[model samples]
Target: MRRPSLLALTLLFGTSIGLAQTTVETIAEGLEHPWALAFLPDGEALVTERPGRLLRVDPQTGGRTVISGTPSVDDRGQGGLLDIELHPEFADNRLVYLTWAGECDGGNATHLGRGRLDGDRLADFETLFVAEPCVRSMKHYGSRIVFDRDGYLFMTTGDRGERDRAQDLADHNGSVLRLHDDGSIPADNPFMERSDVQPAIFSFGHRNPQGAAIHPDTGALWIHEHGPRGGDEINRPRPGANFGWPETTYGREYWGPEIGPDTLAGTIPPIHHWTPSIAPSGMAFYTGSAFPDWHGDLFIGALAGVHLAHLRLNDGHVIDEERLLTDRGRRIRAVETGPDGGIHLLTDHVNGELLRLAPAAR
Candidate 1:
């Protein structure tokens, strides 16, 4: 189970070598914007295609079977079937949580649902949470699901392109929200007593946070969010913390205009920042025995850059970065350590491939 360090892999092969240490094989093809992936108890994977199809992907054999009864998805720009996560007690409860953009009363809304995984199909799906009062814009529906150690569900939602709404507690936009397993707000939330900020708001001022996970050693919530043009950030979330968005950033407007002053003192600094925008998506900390030396390293999937970025940290500061999959030229969407200790990836492309990364056989 003891595998080689990424530093060792790099030193051994150097830049002249491609990602042969990581082998990518097509597990399924013809997927329309495959966004998220989750493992089943049976060793297969459930993949969510952005156009609203869910497939049970068999990693071992590269077989795919479409799961039935998926809810209708609003496939607008950057909106559709999004992140999927399994219930904490999935082995016994068989529950799954999903995020998608769905049509509400008269407009579009972000919907979170739960269902039972039943033999390659989703059954008894019920709406667990819905971003209230649907927004008109179909963009920026930042939806990712995470569960706290205590089993509370933490859902991150975007401001739906309405920047002002992020400051409005009544609106679900641009906020990290916490809810009970069945979708009720925990009274202990920072804003539970305030009527303006909804009881669910865990933190505010996030712009399109797509990657979220718990740090293995610290157990703190960590998030990766897309900045306007150049500044993509890796942030550690905390209660009542304001992560300055429109007000501050190292990025500029997409139109090539300056956003705000760069050296603002009050704005929270990113633990790590990527200039020129890698368009980061999938993020997870490496803890498996496959790479014992990389136990606390952070693995990030880069879409625009079409690479897998490894951030090596020492005492919480990023000291080095290594880019893999440059030769493959595929948008890496999700990166996770597999049950077998190999790094598994669900790529994003016309023909996305599932990849496994380890040290090249000794």
Candidate 2:
């Protein structure tokens, strides 16, 4: 009567995943450590390279044009240019939002910025959010952005390799933050009235959350964070709740010592956790008609497992799971559902690629 780990699940069901008849094609190639992508209204996409380049990729010709005005990034270990997202009213405003690791006092910190798309350059650029009290570490800068129905933006920040920082109210690390479109902290944020807390903090005690998405029907926020050695988590964090990480984890250290007590008081448990760590990255909810049976399912890209995971859900609970693209053996860094009922994937590497998955028979 116990749940199995991701390794067990992969071994049990990896070979049995029967995917739909799909054709895989490399749409764009030669990207350097690509991290995230955002689709434009004109059938093109803006792709981010970890070395701080932003390229506008043409869907048809597989061509790329480097967009000007991309901010300088640290580009160190697990750092660099990251998630990109377009405004909900992008068609009218032509605004794009970006998150990356920027140089701080003596280290790098996650920074979110917004700019207007004007020809091949980003004009009127402005910094939206930047983590505070940056420490000198090369890892764990959690960065992802998702917008809600009301257009408010939510973002994730990691513990910056400091476990105890997660439990601190003043540290921007290890927390989910909410802000208005123009970088102003939301007045209604849970901790806004608390003098000891950051007004932008929505939730705290998170580790390195790599992916975030808004539920289609429920409008709730869901995020996936990496664990130390195992125990990766997918949590639906409510406002002001604590998601236990170093304080309490189901994971063990890389050298085999147990983490914390594995259960901390007043912490909300993950809805689903992968014990053997899938290294889950970008995720999307399939609402497209191209895959009828897959509609309403959640798809997450895996880095360590090197597969695309599909989790079937009913009323927010995962009922079934499947893994695809295991043979390719590439680290999938980002995944998104296209407007044309197809799936777009970005492989992470020095020679990364933008891939498309479509119905083969179509």
Candidate topping TM-score: 2
Q: Tens-digit lDDT track for model 2 on 307-332?
A: 98888888889877878878789899
- Relative to the true structure, candidate 2 reaches a TM of 0.94
Consecutive 10-residue window with the lowest summed lDDT within model 2: 1-10
Deviating ranges (above 4 Å) for candidate 1: 1-22, 263-267
| RMSD, every candidate, angstroms | 4.4, 6.5
**What are the clash counts of all predictions, listed in order?**
4, 1
Error of 1 at 234 (Å): 0.7
Model 2 pairs in collision: 158-174
CA lDDT, candidate 1, residue 123: 96
- List, residue by residue over 1-362, the lDDT tens digit for candidate 1: 22232122222323323433433444555666788888887777888888898888776666789988788899988888988999889999988889999988877888899888888678999988998769888887878888878888888887787777766667778888888988888989888777777778888877778888888887888888887788888888777677777677778888999887654665577888888999889888887897676787888999898988988888778888888768767898887777766677878865666666765555
Q: What's the residue-level lDDT of 214 in candidate 1?
A: 83
Candidates' C-alpha lDDT: 0.79, 0.86
TM for every model, in the order presented, reads: 0.91, 0.94
